[model samples]
Target chain A: MAQYELYRRSSLGMALTDTLDELITESHIDPQIAMKVLAQFDLTIAEALHNRVKAKAAIKGHLHVYRFCDDVWTFIVDRPTFKLEGSETVHADRIKVVACTARAPPGGKPE
Target chain B: MSNQLVPSVYTYVIDEVCEKVAPTFAEMGVGQNVLAELRQTWKRKIASMRVADFDFKESFDDGYGVYDGAGGQYGTEYYGGDHNDSSFAAAANLAALASGVGGDGTAPDSYHIPQNDGAGDEAQAETSKVVETAQPSQREIDELVQRLWQERHRAEGEAAEEQGRGSLAKQRIRQLDGVDDDDDEEDEDDNEDGIGSDLDDEDSEDETADVSHIILCQYEKVNRVKNKWKCTLKDGIITVNGRDYVFNKAQGDFEW
Candidate 1:
């Protein structure tokens, strides 16, 4: 009985703008739309992150997903050296992260 | 090509240009030492920009010999004939079309026939050159930096969260093992009650819930694989290998 919905893929910035546009255009926006937008944002951000990590040959960070309004949201950041298995090398001084989420409609599934 | 040093810092080879040919133009007004320094600086900047990743070779070599230093992988670039009078019409058209440019020469407009006039061709050529020249533009650098920063941040958060989850799981496991403290027992009851109320609200739409549906979305980020969940429910708990996972009342969606 499980159903699935797919959203278009785009950059994090574009996804944010799209979500805002949808909200403004449709007075009664559905959670499914928000979920799709946020999922897309997360995927784009993750791909960019993965590419960077591969290019630099360094362990970049981790992504966190949490439940929000019947959907899931992801936040990404760099892993600290101390927190890693091998703390003897590659110490990170500071890091940054991006937060995004996917929401489902009142009676729909979140993706 | 070996003898005509273009004296350019860029490690790329222009179509027929070689690095050996220090342009007579570069020598006339500029002192030889100054020109050499400029070339060195250009090389350093290119290095900083990491153009090597794009396969830009150091010099160019044609049968007659190199002129501008064009040995690297040829990339789309704008070549200008007259600086001020140059038009990227052709290049722009090509680029526009390539970039999915539409009708009104603007995004969101209907597609139109691309300009095919001389001016249009020149313009398009210019666009091609400029696009190559601007490869590692400031905007690109900023984007790279921003992405890297985000990965770093996400990794940190995940580590912390996983640690927290592990601890919580351990605490719960211990309590379930029947060696729980009074406090632990109380928490179990509280959780059950709370979750039960949530379930009651959820069951109102049980007719639409189904356990067969599950969507797992995973992606690589910051050199790590991350998993995201998507799920909808009907009236039953999704038992995966004898374990139940919480899901909402909607259908699941995901992509590989």
Candidate 2:
């Protein structure tokens, strides 16, 4: 699967970046190495999610804004509740969804 | 339960990335210890986020998670186990600490007496505790001030450009400046909501301001009719409430 740069915005991604930043700042690793690590992270996280996670979530929200641009869909929802399996729920004041097209465009990068 | 999967998924990602990058590190002549250190540091940072009980190592459990739990427990004991009393004390201590460090030295003598109690080891422990709590608040205040300064600079930059535009555009810029100021005020109010609430407040602010609560996944189909929308998203990493969840499939229903 082609890696999307989108997952880099998650907390897991941010934590990785912060750690890499500290390493770079302290001369523990080169910037180039850090970039390679991040690229690897992008691929690994996508595959791990697809292969390892079996959970499903149901989201209900008031859609405030929706945009389809460049084969990606962006949804801004206000006061969203994510109901996962087993009655677990997560509530947020607002959530933004960025979904890449599942079906790869012909001759384009597959998501 | 989905949120519960975060730690393991993250751990898997971290381990896999480390493994994949090992050859590169060796090729670059970087020491393997640094790779191991990177893993440790990454895990430590994630643990500090307190999204869940990581429980990966005894050291992390003792170092960060237990420190947080102990802080709360200490407050409860000090305030006779009353939640409201403990929170009020925590707020007062935060205010006193903030003013003591950020402003003039007039933050009431009562708050300073403990620091000057001269109880030897007891005094040292109390001072360290104060420092431990003070550091995060100081960092947050610094960040908020930096953001406000940046916003001011941006508004000035826009004003300079507005002089070349029509008066209508200038009015629009002014309105935008008003909106920015309102948002700043709201941020300040969030900061003042109390020390205990600060973490959650900052998280939500990050979510809204930086679009942190986002899902990056592949959509199989997204259909809409009237004001209703439905979508089937798969292989997504969803971040909400400062925790990450991975879902193989997600069904979204929303009304505009």
Candidate 3:
């Protein structure tokens, strides 16, 4: 299955890349192995989020900009407020939302 | 909250990736030890980010205790008093070396001079000739030129220390010490302002543009009416206010 690579831009992904880079620099692993590891990460992160995470959130904002391209939607919101699972909330001056198509492509679902 | 679940979700991802990659590592004939090290390093790096309270105790015994102790100490003193003392000592040593070189001018050049006959005047003339030469016989000349460069550098350093104590010299010392938190804050503010002003510029075209706050997810549906919009996003990762949150679903409402 070809998992979405969206979450690879997260901090967790950045940390993994940094660790892999260190190992590559030390000659402990080849770049090919690192690529495999990252591919595995893409799969694992998607699955973990799907199966393990159950929390829901609500976001309210003023949409500054929105674009739909290449089967993805990008929204730029100003002064957004996110109401998380609990009563807790988070506020930010601005946030960019990148949403890929949720429908699984044919033959792309994980077994 | 969704942010509270981030630590466990990240932990699960790390563990699952490590376990799943084992067969590939074995097929490639790479040692399993390297795979284990990769797992440890990945966990350590993520933990260091301090985004959430990650439970590293379950994976390995040697991970959390030592890391927490060392990291705590580093965060407390490494930037405050200890670093200042070390940098001050280093600057003092540099000043002493400069003074030593200045006080005994012939000391640095003594070893560079060839051991000629004990004729002081002739040896001096020989040294002058060596300095004047631009030929392939450059070992001695190189050493003399290096000494001259060091002398010039020391002179410049002393001058900077004397005249630019509040501005250039202190800033240099602060840079060396890596303790300029105010400067870093100012830099971040400037960057944010720059990004805000150029929000409509071509730089926003990149999918992975460096926006400070972002959400990456898959959308189930997005409906709009007039100026109102609603989106149902799934498997989303949200980063806002320097914190990370993950959710299975998010309902967003906004108006253009």
User: Candidates' lDDT values, in order?
Assistant: 0.30, 0.73, 0.74
Ranking of candidates on DockQ, top first: 3, 2, 1
Candidate 2 clashes between residue pairs 3 or more apart in a chain or in different chains: none
Candidate 1's displacement at residue B10, Å, is 22
The TM-scores, one per candidate, come to: 0.17, 0.62, 0.61
Give per-residue CA lDDT, model 2, range B147-216, as digits (tens). Answer: 4445445555655565658867877778989999998878787767654375556445535734557777
| Alpha carbon deviation, residue A108, candidate 3 (Å) | 1.4
- By lDDT, the candidates rank as 3, 2, 1
Candidate no. 3 TM-score: 0.61
Clashes of 2: 0
Model 3 collision count: 0
Candidate 2 regions with alpha-carbon error over 4 angstroms = A105-111, B57-212
* Winner of 1 and 3 under lDDT: 3
- Residue A63 lDDT in candidate 1: 25
Which scores greater on DockQ, model 2 or model 3? 3
- Tell me the tens digit of each residue's lDDT in model 2 across A30-58: 99999999989988987898889999988
Interface RMSD of each: 20.9, 2.7, 1.5
